[model samples]
Target: MSAPSPAPVSTLAPWPYPRWIAHRGAGKLAPENTLAAFRLGAQHGYRMFECDAKLSADGVPFLMHDATLDRTTNAAQVLSTTASNTGGDHPWSALAQLDAGSWHSRTHAGEPLPTLENMARYCIANGFFLNIEIKPTPGAEEKTGQVVGEHAARLWQGQAVLPLFSSFQPEALAGARATAPHIPRALLLDTLRNGWLDLARQLGCVAIVCNHALWDAALVAQVHGAGLRALSYTVNDDWAAQRLIHLETDGIITDRVDFFSPATP
Candidate 1:
């Protein structure tokens, strides 16, 4: 039962338990954001998968991290035909041809960047929960959120696990809220300033996702006080895993999925 409009930030549901989450799908194993990564994460027993989402020039939502296609894709080399398309400026046609998976390995050579709808279909059909980080290109915040949010609303139309939308960009989060208020949102921060909680409250976020180094028990308690969850990202070791658990963080987004638990492998 999807809501016709995005819920007020205050009305979002509490996060489901199990703090261990897979970062960018399977992290270092599979090409991040590809279906392969998600499957690998599932094999590792991760119920939740986190990923970044940005809009292709044609408005398609694809998985990517940097604003430019240079680092991860073959866009810098093979697609030098248009290497100048920085950040969110490239058209979908150009992006679709980039070798998205080859840099990872040959086995994943043909893997193209996945659209939000494609990733959603994979996640839902497999009974997995999602934490989508709205990574908008420099000036594409509103557009990215609207496109991804609309696709998410359509994909999880009747699912029990409402997707968790998170972002460092307030505009992106706000746009997502405006587009699909029913889904939950989390405010991602590297450092917690004095008014951070108030800002999170204004954005209608139900959680705060902080860089692992910045999280502590006091911050966790502060988040809880505001009726929100506190989550951390990029944790890669057992010590940090135990630490987050001890702090009672609601969830952790990590690259080292294998270290967290025993699921498939």
Candidate 2:
């Protein structure tokens, strides 16, 4: 058989996301992946936000970072009557009833989890950019990716800046590419492996979001040379941010939204 065709060139326009993105909305300051966090991030002058999207059992797309709800929500106390440990096992109605914010602090009591559509409307209405990390349930990577991509495409139909999709799973990214090729994608890497650039190219990725320590001047230059942006995540300290800035990285995801001024970067 002939060789498989190479991935098509990315038609994505220039990168529009801000260099500084508030991680999980407002990071540790508020309930992550909740509307409260997003609003707090905005209050701190963040223009771009990064959140995780996964599908419930009923296939409704929602904002949640973990596979299980034990850490972020009172699922155990509230859903004790149910046998579901994973968020994907519950319908949207059940998931909606769980208090997603009370675990963070009493101040955010009763803050419910925000659906992907809820986030989309809020961001679109306020002209905010988003980096949507497709965090799928086990064995459902492709399905989650496709659904989230389709939803994002429809949600941001006429918006100027589409949500940037990123994932550590290649299958998910592939599913996304098949479902909505117009929305830009990025490869998320916690550890740099050999031929990563080739993999990113094969996946038609516009950027590579890496662990903050993985980036340096040469790597940044190499990614730029390959026509893809280089971004680092969870960068909270001044030195790390300064280092990434010095390397001329394209984007920086940070947990310290209140500490780091997005306006400067």
Candidate 3:
């Protein structure tokens, strides 16, 4: 028989992570990036979660999505007399005392921001997977990435699968890579700029996290062809989830933890 073309070498790498991930812990069901949200996600059977991580004035990596604490925390009240209410303007000691959960709802009132170390402990103890998105303050991109990456490396040293580090800022990814070269890193893409693929490769990313709408069959093949996994974020609806599944995208970050069973995915 004609030599069978060496069984097409599989482009897919060994992805140890689960297919489904909970967005900002439990998404809108609970306050984003709070430990309570993670607890609730676990209750709904989610094994993996994605959260935003940024540094405080003292450089402690903690969870919160916005640059200003105004939207998520009672910053206006807590920082009433302070010169600045920006999250990164305060030390973690001060940041921690702010009510992070009350903004979402009264039930989560008094919830404090969980440090990355605190998150590491919970996930490691419960055998959960995490994707930490390095969210840098305006002027602290590289520093935030370095700090978060260093902390993550130290925290999950012996874990089988280290937490994934992802960011839209290339410099942030570069910093993380410098600190924790062994931990897997992914490039977060909101839009396909020129030579995006080349940039991702340059950053040594194992995966590409994109907005759900940006994905299609050709793009999946393109990413796979480059030996990278294609992952989508904020995929909430059933139709979109089905589409990614159909296209064979490697991972899905979603707010609908209850709608999609992680156990089955």
Candidate 4:
């Protein structure tokens, strides 16, 4: 079945992943993309987590969502000498020194940013699955994807389940596919632009993770018809989750690890 052709939804193969995914590790409970958030997510019985991985100045892959460090880490205080607050602006040596968790609350203070290797060890040892979003730095999209893909392959070598890499940038996905074709990839959509489905097909995506509101019965059917699984992100409300369930989408990424039960769905 071609990716753009419609087929029966029943033609779908068994999904290799869990239905529930914790966003940015534990979402708002702890600092985003930190190991502390992953631990909290595990406590909530979440088996899968969605993280943003990007490259540092020295080409090391680390887990951080934004291009800048000011929002989630203490780059302002730690790197005061230089007014630069971008994660990619400094090497991992400097990024590793900042406090990543203190911004969330007093209890989570002093948490350091986790390297992709740090995350891999933690997840592989605990039998957890990660959806690594190739959040590339501007002008370095393909390079970030290549570095992340290479590291993910090496780190998770000989493991049963590899990481599911997803990205909004097609170049990033292409780069990952080039370096590590064996790992599964997904196309993340905030909006369904013209020829978006074709884009997913060209990238050889195993699934489509869209903004939750973008899905409807027709869209779900179209994706399934093309022989791909449908997934959504940042889904927090009960009504929206129920709607996606009604559509029978394959995956749901949520920040509300506290509310959703991963074991149930």
Question: In TM-score terms, which candidate is top?
Answer: 3
- State the TM-score for model 4: 0.95
lDDT by residue (tens digit), candidate 3, 1-265: 8775766778788999999999999978999999999999999999999999999999999998888888998878877675586789899888988888998899999999999999999999999999999999888999988998899989999888899999999999999988999989999999999999999999999999999999999999999999999999989999999999999998999999878898765
**lDDT of each residue in 83-200, candidate 1, tens digit only:** 5757467777878787778889998898888788888888888788889999998888987888889989998998987889999999999999998999889999987766899999
When summed lDDT is taken over every stretch of 10 residues in candidate 1, the lowest stretch is: 6-15
Which pairs of residues clash in candidate 3, taking residues 3 or more apart in a chain or in different chains?
Answer: none
Off by over 4 Å in 2: 1-13
Give a tens-digit lDDT track for model 4, residues 123-158.
Answer: 999999999999998999999888888999999999
State, as a TM-score between 0 and 1, how close model 1 is to the true structure.
0.90
TM-score order, best first, reads 3, 4, 2, 1
Residue-level lDDT of model 2, residues 135-246, one tens digit each, is 9999999999999988998999988879999999998998899889999999999998888889999999999999999998888878887889989998999999999999
**Overall local distance difference test of candidate 3:** 0.92
Report how far residue 152 has shifted in candidate 4, in Å.
0.6
Per-model TM values vs. the true structure: 0.90, 0.94, 0.97, 0.95
